[model samples]
Every structure is written in structure tokens, then in C-alpha cells.
Target: MDLDDHGLTFSADAVMDETEELRNPFPSPPSHYTKYTTHNLDLLALYNERLPDRRNESQAQILADQTDVPDWPLTQLEKPRIDWILEEPEPYYDVFGERWFVKDKIPSLGEGGGTQLYPEDPTVDRRPALLGILRSLLVTYSQLTSAILAPPPSINLSPANTEPPKPEWEEKVEWITVLAQNLMAAANDLRPVQARGNLELMMQRQLQLRREETKALHDKCDILDAKLNELRAAAQLISSRGDSTDVAMSDPTPTKVVPDDVLAEDVLRWAEEVE
Candidate 1:
């Protein structure tokens, strides 16, 4: 693996297993194809050009050792000789196309009932492998015909079923019942305490409200007291003004000197008026 700024990279092997994946990278169909658009046609052409060439089975299985799993190495030479004659000649392609090809029947070879043997490797006896395959098939068939198993599958736990056994279940139920009863008793016991807490909270809330009301009243009193002080000052100013005014009436013009002579004459008249 080579590390680069982008990411770690590795050389891709000629892994023919992903042959189908090459087609996936091709351009997809356009949304509207009612009419031929130049872009769409161009894309189709490009897609055709990019398509990988079809490979023969032998060539596809590059690692011959690994390809033996699917491809027959023996198929390289020629199709095996079959004795039975068919009305139609079997079709075949040299490059291993969609269909396998069979050559014209060689009337020279007689009917054979067994699998083809490796003539070169004469020491290879296929009887043992055939018997082993037959045994496996028999075992598989027997298992398929056997009775159905209805056993419940276990989840995360392995020791037992998710549901406990009867005795353990009963014990659990009893314990739950006792727990519920205890819970009920405890709730019953806490009722008075809970109520007391609630009442205390209410009392505290009421006290807070009363304090607010008192503060509001005090604010109003302060306002009124200020108003009263203003009024008192105004009243004091009026009283002082009235007290500073003249206490007795005074003549505007000066008293005349003839007033004495006139007063002597007026005194008799005044005495007469008084009498």
C-alpha cells in the first residue's frame, strides 16, 4: 500500500470477479428519451466505447489454479465424445460464449455411462471421490426428510429461555408482589409528610404575596406622604403670608394742623353724636 495525500492506495489485481461492476460505471439513461438528444446519443456512444471486451471462461479464470472451482481445465482440449446421436448438432463457441459447443458425434467411440477420466494421469481413481459425493448427497437428503425442529431459538442469553422456569417465575412474581405492597405502604406513609411539604410551600408563597402587597402599600403611603408634605408646605406658606400682612388700618394722607381746631369743634359734635 502506498500512502498519499488523498488516501492509501493499492494496485488492483486482474480480479475478473468484478467484471459486471465495469458496466455499472456507464452513463445512465436520461430523464426524457422520447426524442434523440445529441447529449444522450453522445453518452450512449461513450458508454459503448467504454464497455469491456467479452472474455472466454479460460481467460477469465486467469489464475488457473483458482479458476478450477468453476471452469473445467479438461474443457480446453475438446468436448467429450458422447455415443447417443442427436437430431441437431450441438452449437459451441471457441471463446466460450453464452452457450457451450459440442462437436459432431464421433460414431467411432461407443456409449459411455461414467464421468470423463484424466487419461494422462491414469493413477487418479475417481471412484473414491464419487462415493464421497454420493455419501454427502445421501446425508443431505436424509436431513431434509427428517422431522421439523420447533425449538425456540435463544437470543443474547444462553443459559435458559428468556422466560424463567415455573418455580423461579413464581418466586419473581411473589417478590414483585411484595415490592408493590411495600411501595404502596411507603406511599401511604409519606402522604402526611408530602402534604406538610405542600402546605409549607403554600404558606411560604402566601407570605411572599403578603410581603409584596405590604411593599405596594408602603410605596403608596410614601407617595401620599410626599403629597401631604407638599400640601403642608403650601399651607404654611399661605399662613405665613397672611400673618405678615398689616395688623391695623392706617390713614393714607397726613393729618392736617387745622385738624386740631377742626377737631375741637368736631369734638363737641362728636360728643353730641356719641350722646
Candidate 2:
């Protein structure tokens, strides 16, 4: 079959065959395969361009020997086979527009029960060999996005069904009861002494008030005694005045040169006049 009829003009087998002929030593080298020919020289240039510089010097020397090329200043013939192994085809490019090319057999839906490509109809269920791969990639991407965007789950401390136990409050109440008992015991021990002290203070205050009241009453009695003495002196003065008046009235004109008989007659006259 003419390969061009199937839209495939370039054959990897033809290129490999030509390369083998150039490496063979039994026949004289073909003029078309010389280093100056456009085809051979183009292939050699591409090979040299693609050869990695980091290859070991020993490997480079072996490659130079295999191609019957000198090692003085590296040439295209000395380049490794790996340099040309993935040479780009002319017809197509990779997804990123890079010049890598590969040929693969994409299985149809019914071929060897392998994965299906370009599936038709909405209802037909066809299992794909790459389903697990796609599922894993989607799951990984979703997990990454969720980790970046979603809020963290809340951690609730409350009980799910019933109330949590109150051990802290119960412990506090127990402590309070113990403290109250201790306080009651201390109060009982010191009750009589405190009551005795309060009673003594009250008695001292009452004694002080009684002393003040007694002093005030004694002062009032002293004032009353002084007023009674003043009244007795006034009564004695009145009594003395009355006694002098009586003596003057009984001896009227007796001392004026009269005899005892005249004095008696004078007393009778004065007594009759006073009656």
C-alpha cells in the first residue's frame, strides 16, 4: 500500500533503515548518505543539537567509536542514538505546540474490551479503562480546592444526648459544707468567752451611768439641805424679834424713877391699855 494514501507519508522504518546503511562498513558509503547531503546532514545536525552535554565522557567516546567518528572536536556522527530516538515528525505537534511526536493505538468501544474513546449515545453505559485514573485526579483536585476554600469544621463541647455531669459544682458544695462545719466548731469553742466579754462591757457601762445618776441625786439633796438651813435661820431671826417685842411691852416705863408699888400699878395700867 502507498503510505501517502492513508495520510502517512513519512515512515519510521524507512528512516531507521537508511540510518543502518550509513553505519554499515561492507560497501562504500553512498553519496546520498554523506555528511554534505541535505537529508543526511539535516538529520546529523538535528542529532547533534539534541545530544545532552551531561552524558559521561566515556559514553561519548563509545558513541564516537560506534559511528567511526573522531573524538577530537565532537561532530554530529559522534552523537548518541538517544538524541534522534524521539525526533519530531513533520505533520503534527504536541498539545503545548512542542515538537515531540508519538504514535499510539486508541482502542474503540468494542476492541478487546479495552477503554472506549468517542463514545456515542447518552444511555449506553461503557466502562473505560482510564476511569480510575480520571476519578483519582478529580478527587485529588477537589480535595485540594476544598482545603483551600472551605471553612474548618466546628468542634462542639456540649454533650450530644444528655447533659454533662456537674462534678465541679458538687465539689464546691462539699467544700462549703466542710468549711461551715469547721466554722461552727470554732464558734462553739469560743462562744462562752465572747459572751462573757460582752456581759462585762454592758455591766461597766451600766455602773458608769448609775454613778453619774447617784452623784446628781446627792448634789440635789445637798442643795435642799442648804435651803432648809437658810429657812431655819430666817425663822430664828423672826422668833428673836418677837421675844424682844414681848420683853419691851412687859417692862414699859418701869425703869423711870417709879417705886415698886408704882411699877406694879403702871404694869396693871399698861396691861389694861394693851387689853
lDDT of 2 at 172: 47
TM-score of each: 0.28, 0.31
Q: Candidate 1 residues 139-218, lDDT tens each? A: 54454344223343344645655663344334444444443443344344456779999999999999999999999999
TM-score of 1: 0.28
Best by TM-score: 2
What is residue 189's positional error in candidate 1, in angstroms? 0.9
Q: Evaluate model 1: give its lDDT.
A: 0.48
Query: What's the CA error at residue 116 for candidate 1, in Å?
Result: 83
lDDT of each: 0.48, 0.55
Indicate the residue-level lDDT of 191 in model 1: 69
